[model samples]
Target: MTSMMAPNAAGLSDADIANLAAHIASFGGAAAAPAAEAPAAEAAAAPAAAAGDVAAGKAKFAACAACHGMNGEGQGMFPKVAGQSADVLADKLKKYRAGETVGPMSAMMAPNASGLSDADIADLSAYMASL
Candidate 1:
């Protein structure tokens, strides 16, 4: 008797093939993973500075201008961040700093946000919101 196997079988178990098929199907042929959630503690942490300085935020934003534009109008695939709420921006930054994949750009943002403190997030958020 001959054992029937899948045509593309290359040491992968039937279950493994099924799982791979499911994953591929979920993305409609694209291989994107779902966004990760932020840790509860990190998500709950309040902004370090009570009031953010727009000047400081502007200074800090110099690094962000390359992709976001000097006026915060995002270029190409980059999303526009200007006019976002301070709280929302801070939360997203905190999530990025914690290495959570909040969006498609999380990989790029994680490195940039890693060095920011809560105070820095506040300042940056304030500046971005002002725009």
Candidate 2:
């Protein structure tokens, strides 16, 4: 079998790092990257948020209130989502939908995120960030 280095071990080109930074910035988050292969980590977390309707996002968020609370404050064991950048929220939801484990809540979140379309993600992210 061919040996594969870890993404960090392999490192990233300058162009790749710049692209990752741009992607993060588009999501309204600060562009931060290590001097090494930081692009791998950033790329994994980066997802673009499409334009969304805040009103609709609010309506959609009601379904999430059971765990996240009406204001996205999050209840016990459900981490706070309010004020998170749109890109972060969208990327996390996307990962959950794809059944990729992100944290302790991965199993619980998978089902909730499974049915979300890109538009849904965008709307939800917008709503959560506005909180």
Candidate 3:
């Protein structure tokens, strides 16, 4: 953090005060892009998940192994999904698939959920829940 002269402090030159003020102004103002663009970018990058089947979910989960771990233990920023409730998991996936939740990873999972039927969602939910 850069400090400026306290209202009445020392011998600062005019340029020094101007530079500091500029720096301070720069800190709060938007650089170029509007803040609204960020959410749009995230939405575009992420995929939306949706309802799926439990039995079919197992097969679907197979494709998720690379990042979620073989047993859904998860790694790094990836969350552990093995013991998650089916209802919750299904809901989250549905959000991702619908683009309601945007993120690069969510976007990736969205397409995977595209063709899933209701039974597939239930099965996957049950399988993941049981795990």
Candidate 2, 1-61: lDDT as tens digits: 1132133223556775575445434444332221222366665564546586677788777
lDDT against the true structure, each candidate: 0.71, 0.69, 0.56
The candidate with the higher lDDT, 1 or 3, is 1
Task: Give me candidate 3's TM-score against the actual structure.
Answer: 0.51
Q: After superposition, how far is residue 35 of candidate 3 from its true place, in Å?
A: 30
Report how far off residue 84 is in candidate 2 (Å): 0.6
Given candidate 2, what's the lDDT at residue 34?
A: 15
Alpha-carbon runs more than 4 Å astray in model 3:
1-56, 102-104
The candidate with the higher TM-score, 2 or 3, is: 2
- Tens-place lDDT digits, model 1, residues 32-56: 3334565678656744334778788
RMSD of 2: 17.0
lDDT of 2 at 127: 84
Q: Runs in model 2 with CA error above 4 Å?
A: 1-47
